[model samples]
Structures are given as structure tokens and as C-alpha cells.
Target: MQAMENGGDLPRRIGVYTVERELGAGGMGTVYLARSRGGRAVAVKVARPELAADPHFRARFRAEVEAARRVGGFHTAPVVDADPDAQAPWLATAYIPGPTLAELIERQGTMNKEQLRSLGAALAEALQAVHACGLVHRDLKPGNIIMADDGPRVLDFGIARAVESTRLTATGAAFGTPGYLAPEQAQGDEVGAAADVFALGAVLVAAAGGSAFGTGTPMGLMYRSVHEPADLSALPGELRSLVASCLSKDPAGRPTPETLLGSLGPDPNPSPDPKTLALATADRPHVAPPVPVEPPADHGRVDEPLRRAPAELSRTPRVMILLIAAAAVASALVGGFLALTRHGDDNKGGGPSVTASDSRRATSQASTPPSTPASSRVAAAPKDRVTVVVTAKSGRSWISAKDHNGQILFDGVLDNGETKNFTDKSQITLVLGDASLLQLVVNGKEVPNDFQPGQVERLTYDRSGEMY
Candidate 1:
């Protein structure tokens, strides 16, 4: 299942939707819980930066978005709006407010035979509509299935096609989740509608409390999918054969969605209400929701200064010092000697003070600090250690930080005027959903970047305060 991180940097608005909070993040992009100006709740998915930058991906995304809009069925979240030409291409769909199938399984254990039949029939019907539109949902797993009040609702359909040939998949990495991907996808073969049926079988296996190919590494899972048989021991005898047919090694051997729908028959028992299921599945003791707090009066003002550490020097003076030192050293080094001096007057009147309005321009011009020899830089701090401070300034932004071991340090939204400090003994990797919303300090120095508003930023830092 894609790990669900809560409360991410909420963009004030995406298109006509007012973003309220983050729902989750996936291979495609971050999904936000947003509302239209008319107050209709919607789930908006913005494409990852790498995907948006590719013309090939954009074309496919535009086409798939159009096709997805045409897909209409009771068992699928309907596409509501899209903007593939935007700086970050995005697609919005009717929001399904319920725990995902994966979350439900985790909370309540595997489903019974009646529930399984209902789920299978609904998903197959959803896939039929998707295929009718000439689109295939490349990724179909429990996480993408929402257990709505009425029934199961498939999500993220048609969007996966855009990711197929992108740089992310250019390295021969498969496009879908490991265990749930079809055998053809595992082997890097051209996939068709049959792939979704294969994934559906795997999802059923999971719902039955077993792995289709058993649990292991991504490579192992794919290997098993391609070369080994699926273990359907957990399924009931009546359902096993149907699921087995869907897991066939050959694409032609699998049942089509229409065939599966016909065979699954009617559900004898309806699923419990989604609200009841959610209450039953609580992972932790319930806590009251935090009280709402008023946003700072200066919210969204670009001129607001980032929360700075007391010991850190002002960015303007530090930059000027480095530029002056570099110029002096360049001229004096010819004599085999170098001398540098700084006067207090340089800070007061030697140049115009950098105001908040000029912050972006000034920082852009002097972002890179003068490089020093490794002996001078690395000797002062432990090479393995790093520290980063992120402060939301102009707006709110979602930020995620991970360590060298792939442990998440923080994953959530940083509200306007909020500050978070993270330190690690090894490398620290950071992802910012809206780069313009925040300022970063690495180690003890301000780390200037030339990130545009709404541009996704990924940065890795080490003890020397250098970004990789």
C-alpha cells in the first residue's frame, strides 16, 4: 500500500479548487482534498515535476485525462476537471470519502466470501467502463480501491498511461506496484486491458489474506509474478478457480472484465456501512481533533522574513562578504600572498540594503556560496551529520524529509509562519511540494535556491551544507 502521510502543504488553490489538505501521495503526484468555489469536495492529483517536464508525458497525460473524463460508472470515481497544460498538470475527480480497501483490510482483517464477490463484481464493472474508453488502469491494488458507502470505487484509472514512457520508467523500472502488477508488466512487456484483470486477481488475493506470489522484495515479487505460480490457498474453493484464471501467465489466458462480471454473480450480503468500518478499524485510540487556529495576518505575504536562527548572520551580509573575499583573493593571489579585511561600513552604506521585495532576485544572484577546500570545510563538522531548518514564509507547503536509511523524519504540511528543524547523523533528503512557500537553512548557513512558485524541489544535504 502507498503509505498515507497526513496534512501536507496545502496550496491556497489549484485551478478553481481550494485545497484543504493532502490526502496522499503516489507515483503520479500528491493528491489533495479540495473544494470547488461552489463547495463540492474533489480529489485533485497534480503530476510529479519530472512527469510534467516531459513533452511525451504531457501529451499522453492530456489524452488520458480526456479519456478518463468519458469513463462513467457507479463503481469508479468520476473525473471532474483537468488541466494538462498547466505548469504542473493536474486531474481532479469526485472525492470518495472512506477508508481505502487496503486500510479496511488492515483494520478488519480479510473479507468474507460475500464481501469478496461484491468487491470483485464492482471492480470488474469499473474496469469494463475504463476499457470501453480505450484506457487501462496500469496500477490496480487495494490502495486504489475506496470502500464508499454504496460500494467499492476505483481511482487513478487512465492516469498511469502517462507514466509508461516517462524518464521514471525509461530505466526499465516497471510502472506499477510490485506484488499487484501483472506478469507482463513484471517482464517489461507491452500491457493491455488484461493487465488490470491480472492486478485485480492480486488485489483479491490480498483481500483474502494472502499474497498472490507470496511476500518478498520488489524484484522477488516481480520474478515470482513472471516465473512462479500464484498461491491461492487462502481463497475459498468457489472463488479460487475464478481468481486463478485471472492470474494466468499469458495475457490471452485471463478473463476479460465482462467475463469476470458475468461469473462473479450477485452479492448475497452487502458490505457494512463505511462509517462503521472506519470506526471498527481505528489503528490507535481515538483522539479529539485539534481546535482550529487563525492564520497569521501576514499569511501569503512574500515579504515576510523566514524564521531565522538567532546565531545565524543576515543573508545579505554573508553573501557580500563571500563575493568581496572572492574578488580580493582572485586579484591578490598573483603575488603568492592573500589578505582580506572587512569594515563595518560595508554593512551600513557600501551598497543598498536588500529589502524583502528584492529577496528573490538577490538570492538568485548569490545563491551559491564560495567553495572552500575539503580540508577546511569537512574538518570542522562530522562528515556524516547534517541539519536542516525549514520555515514556511510566503505560504503553506508540504514537506517530507528522509534519512540515508530511508526512514521518514517528517512528512506533513508546514503552515505559514511555522518552522521545523530536522537533524540527522547521515544524509538528509527533502521534498518540497511548493518550493516558493518556504526557506531552508542547511547546517548553520542559509541555503538559497532558485525555485519558482509551485515548482517541486528535491534536495539532499550533508554536513558541509552542500546540496546534492
Candidate 2:
């Protein structure tokens, strides 16, 4: 049911539970922290009044309760209470004390190999539970996973209408985060386990420290999910194909969540005691496996911020390359953002391309560029930050321009198949293939982007419509 008021907090005690605090709000409702009569902490979700009046929504919620009830996994937050018939129907589940995975990724850019492997394993395990029960967690995204001390826990089942439910979903009703949604879901195909896997693929990109779908706003990502090839350029080699398997558009081509876990190595970060972690963080903490990351043992890896650079700068496949060569010779500050990861800057700038090592070097080295000479500062305010984007498909990298914020200054590919940077704040978004997300790099550090561009490099895909 919808909250009685728009943008207003929900009322306490819908029936027997008491609302404690507002957790979050959505277009249809607000999620709250509440307590049941048994003194258990519960996450109570109340719908907006408008939605409550819709019989279709009510039927969906009623069936959702049953579908969610079938879920059984250590990685899932168990549902404990509900009142599908209340005037403002609501469902309550045990309160999961932790920040969402989305929160953790924003705080810490991509996870090193070990962390990615750990995440893949845990999430795969969680999905296995969901799949086994014959229930699909239609909504799976970074924001949906809670990083508890134990492991990543999946949440939110309100939008999940059981397949067996006789009630039809409201016309044009679509659920789940845009970038993370599968292609089939976008096309309004009846979904099942595969849809969730596609979402898992996007989630992994985010977990590994890349944008969910390159760049652009949430809406842009949704558009990309529907029509473009995925940008998995930042993905580590061992796991890239694994993620690809999950993203397969053909439902039969994708792996069951359980099968997905089989591809990842064992978990290195042992789950900690939730009680102890809760005591330490005070507030609900969304825990990560720990950072200053180390890659998995199979791969020769070292500290993340201090590791040796990859052999080549990561690149999008194709004849399209960014004018990195031209940019390097023209300006001292080629990339954007701050935080040096390497020693003295590479003034020569003539580095090898296509290798991950070089990309690492660029990130590490440019990250530590020496102070800018006072003479050249004024002429290039817009070019103050350089952005680099890598993509899964092939493409000729290009450059455009954007203002200080994320507004588009220009849009086109500047170069093809090479490493480069820009100083202009005309925020450059690397468009990989015909995708919605523009692989974005602000001043160098990987950052999320809206559709508004600075400048952008075009990505070319060897193949397209990659999902299956």
C-alpha cells in the first residue's frame, strides 16, 4: 500500500507493529524500520495511497508475500510478518542492520580480484537459494544487497509477483533497477532465473569497481539495458566470461545462480559475527571484505593502490580509439579527479595500449601527476579533468566536451583504440557500442555519470546485442 501522504513518512502500527524510523522511499511507497509485537526489529514496507487503491497492486502484493516466503538462503533476509489485507497493506521482515552494497561501492571503487571472487561466490550462493525455491528475485541490484558482517544479503520482494499468481501484473508494470535489469525484462518478456542472472552480471561490474553500465543517468542505464551491448571492459579476465554467462539474453544460455557460484573461487573473507560488528559500527553498517585490495592467488597480484600496473591500458575493442596520443602531447593534466596511486608522473606519456598493466600504470601514475606548472592553468579550465573509459565491446574512442558539472558540451568519438585523457571538465563519457552508459572517468578516478556528457570516446563492439 502507498503511504498516506506523498513524500511523507508512514504511520506507525499499521496493525500490531510500531514504526521506528524511515529507511527509504520509492515512487510507490516508503520502507520503514519498525518492530513487531515480539520485539523483533522489522523492515516494514508501506505502499503509497494511490497504489493501495489499485486492486491489481493488492493482488500482486498478496502473491508476492507467498513468493517471498519461499525464499530460503543464508544470504537472504527472512520475512517474518505481513498483513496483505490491511487498509494500507504492508509486509515486514527482520531488520537487516547494514549499508547497502551500492553504498559500499561508492565509498570504495572497484573491488580487487579477491573481493570480486568473494562477492561472486556469496551472491551466487544467495541466488542459488532463490532459484531453488522456484522464486525469482526480479529486483537484484547493488542497492538491493545489504553488506552485513556475515556476507551480502539480498532484500526487497514487494515487486516480485509469483509466476503462478492468477492476477496479471499491471499493464506496463516493470520492476527492478534499470541498469541492472536484464534485456528480456526490458522487452517485457516473462522472466525467470535468467533475468536475475542478468542483473547479477551488472551487479558484478559495480562490485568489481566499474559503473553498473558504464555512464549516463539511471534512466540512461535502463535504456542501455534494453538496446545496447554491456560494457564489461573493467572486469578482470577470470571473471569476465563468468559475468558474461550470467548476462546471456537467451534464458537457457544463462547459469542458475547456483551454477554461477561454481565458477568463482572459495571465499577468503570469513563472515564475521553480526552482533560484534553491529556493536562496533553503532549504526547499521554495510560491511565490505576490507580494502587496499589484493587480487586472488591464482593471478599474480599485489596491493590495489600500490600494485604494479597492468601491461596495457584497458581498451574497448574496435578501430575507434580516443585521441589519447594527441591529448598527452598537448596538455600536462590529461585525466580528471585526484588521489595519486603511483610515483612521479609519466611526462613522456608514450605508453603501450590495450594491456591492463598500462591502464593500471595510467591510473597509478596519472593519479600521482606532479604539480601543474603555474603557466598553463588558465587556458584550459574546461579541459581541467581528463576522462578515460574502457568497454566490453569494440569501439573507436572519441572525445567531446561537458561543463564543470555533468552537462554535455559535445558528443562524438575523438580517437580509436588507444589510451588517452582530457583536461577539460567537459566531462568525457566513453560510449561503448550503442550503449546507454557512457564509460565515464572524471579527472581519472572512476565515477558514476549521468547522460549529460563532458567529452566522450566511442566504443566499438566486435559483436553486438551481447546478452546471449
Candidate 3:
């Protein structure tokens, strides 16, 4: 049997579902891995008690499940059963196990033309199914998709609408992840299938591979999502035009799902491959990594302002910084279920599995053809150590890593960006904010007076997010 993806902390079962683990958690509820009587493991999402008392909330949740079911396509996670009437209603779907497209990019990164074509085609076909069902998946971020062995599996449908549902909107809330949210949704206008398309555009660019626009910080990404130019700068070649259309400010002008779907089909790998990361210095073995929980701290802690202090890039040790980052990148490659599983085999421990948004990403080359089989799967690979990567494109940017001994381990320049793995040490070299330049600071102190650009240095860190 394939080892669990993100659902490691859940009980053995819940309700009639044999709960295997926690798949992921969201603002409204926690998703668990459970099995049906026929022995199929399912992704079951149960609403939180906070929102369960509201009738409209339950209605919308039910609606999302129904809407997901109506969308007759294999690109989506197949809904097997649901009970919106329960005090805390829940929906269960056949589990498709795999990392998310986001996780895939972090691991494999920026697919070549063939992979892009396949991903675009499969997702477009999925969107066509969604639109045909008279519903819209207001949220279509990379985290919502699994690049399954079968194909791209779209999950978390009804909840977005359920989120937008009037009964649940007593306080006037938003329906989607900020960066991918459409202008209309940002403006609180009536949304339709176009919103999903716009989101799909963002998903495609992200899948094709690019640094996050808003740095995964709430206000900045949301602002950029709404006011910024459709930044497809990271996208290469022919894709830029199509992605731009999906990210267009005007919803009416967006391409129809059918039109987009018609343009996709599998293709062979293309020339000038996207890019390949270096394995590691010949002396060392590739370190396994832990899962990354994208630290969804809140809208307040969004890293935008923190991004403004760009000069700090040179303030810390490159070696320590890179080691920490390598750890994170490695973690992100796991499907987003690591932390929920970390909370460990408990039922009531469901009090909000906290983590950041870019939890996992999955990318794929093949899968089912929009129908037939259901359920997602993953490999039982050994855990990897998340590491720092300094890319070749990172001009003027350098890297530094230091082991717990305060000795510099690895230091170098990332033309764009390069990567390596490290452990959970109190100090580390890291790339700060979203830039390529790395710094060496520990517990908010600069590493050393001699540490300079074009040189390796030592640094430290105590907490996961800061230098020790």
C-alpha cells in the first residue's frame, strides 16, 4: 500500500469511514483519510463546529458537494458520499493520492513544454466539466489540485461556494485564496465560471513554475492579484499569452472553458528543457526532507512589508540560510498532509491543523481520461531534509550554510537559484524574503564582520522562521 500523503495524524476511522489520517485542514474544517465499506480510502472533509450551527453554512456545504458531483469529469476528485445534515456536516470523495502541482514544482520544478501542455490540457478539460455543470470553483489554487498518476484531480469544490454561500457570509467574507482570486471576486461582484478560469490561469503559471507573486503574504498577494499586472514574467514562451488571458482584469473577456479545453492534448517533451537542479556536491548523499506547512500565520503576518527590506539579503550567513531553505523546499515536495499527520492519531485533536498555504504541490504527466476510476495515491518514499537552493538566475545573490558547530558548510552564489538540504539547527544560512541574495543572521544578529558578498559565512537560528 502507498504510504499516506498528508493525513498522518488522523484516527483509524471516523463515522462509517475508516479514518486513516488527516489529509489537510482549512478555515472551515479538517479533511481526513477514511475508507468506505468496499475498502476504498476516501478524502473526507468535516465542517468545524464554529460554522456548523448556521443552516446556510450546512446548505452551502451540501451544495458544494452536489455541485462537485454534478461536474461529470475525471479531472476532479470523485465525491462518493456526504452528510450535510449532520451537526458538523462532512463530504467524502474517493482519495487520489499524490503531491499537489505546487509540491511537484518545488520538487521537480518548471516542467518543459510537453509537461506544461499535458497539465494545461488536463486542467482545461477539468474546467470545461466544471463550467458545464453550472457552477464555479471560486478557488483554484495549486493547493487545490493534485497532479495524480491518473491526471490532475480537482478537490475542494463545494466549499468555495459554500464559503461564498450567504448563510455563511454573515460577516461579509471572501471566497478564494487571495493570489489566484479574480478581480470580480476581489470586488465582491457576482462571480461565474470565468472566475474559475482566471484562477486556472494562475494555477497554470504556478504549475509551469514561478516564484509566488505576493510572496505568499496575504495583503500583498491579494493586492497584486487584484491590482498588479497579470505577472506571468516567470512563464516561458507561448504560455505567457494564454496565461495572461486567464488572468485578465475583465471577467467577460476571459476565454470559455470549452475553448481552452479544445486547445489541450498530450505532447512530447520540448527543446530547451525548463531547467534541472544540481544533485549535490559529489561528496554528499541527497538528504531526505520533512513536509513543509506553508505557515498560514494570518493576513497580518503576510511577508510584503518584510519584503521591502531587501537590503537585508546580505546581512546573514549564506551557508546557514541555504541549509534552512533547502529544508523547506524539500518539505514542500511532500503532499500537504504532513503536519495534520504530525499532530498524530487523535480524533479531537482536530482543532485547526495550522500551516502555511503553499503546503504541497503535485505535477503529473499521465492519469485517467476524465472518467472511470477514482481515488488519489502517493509513494511511500523516505522523508527528505528540506534545503536551500540558490538559482543561477539569482544575480548578485550569494548563499551560506553553517552546521550546529558554527562552521560554514556550503556557500556560493545562485546565478538564479540553487538548492541543498540541512537539518533543524538553531542557526542556518537562508535566502530572506523572496530574493536570490542570501544573508547570515542568527537571533536577529548579523553573522560576522568579515562575512561579505562573494564569500561563505556561518550563521544560526532557533525558531523555524527566524535566525537563531
Using TM-score, give the best candidate's number.
1
lDDT of 3 by residue, 1-468 (tens): 222355654455555887767778765578888888888889888876756777777777777777778767879887788888876688888889899887888898688656777787788888777778777878788888898998888887647777654322211233467677774564344577778888888887677655335464333454345434555655665566677777765665578777776655543333422232224333444643333333221122223422443333223211111121122455333111100011101112121221321132111112112222111111111223212222232333333344444333433233222333333334344322123144232222333323222221122344443432
Better of 1 and 3 by lDDT: 1
lDDT (10s digit) by residue, model 2, range 189-255 = 3466777888888888888766545554333454345433465666776677778777654556677
lDDT for predicted candidate 1 compared with the true structure: 0.68
RMSD of 3: 23.2
TM per prediction: 0.56, 0.54, 0.55
Instruction: Please report, as a residue range, the 10-residue window in candidate 3 with the lowest summed lDDT.
Output: 337-346
Candidate 1 lDDT, 1-468, residue by residue in tens: 122255445577788888888999887888999999899999999988888888988998899988999999899999999999988899999999999999999999998778888789999999999999989999999989999999999999988778765645222222677778775554334578888999999999899888887664443455346534677777766688889889876676689999998888784444466676667666645744334343332111111112322112123221222222234544332111111111111111122223331232211011122232212332344446786777777655655566665444554445555555666787777656556678787776666756655454456787778865
lDDT of each: 0.68, 0.53, 0.53
- The TM-score of predicted model 3 comes to 0.55
| Model 2: CA > 4 A from native | 1-10, 162-173, 217-219, 267-468
- Model 1 RMSD in angstroms: 22.2
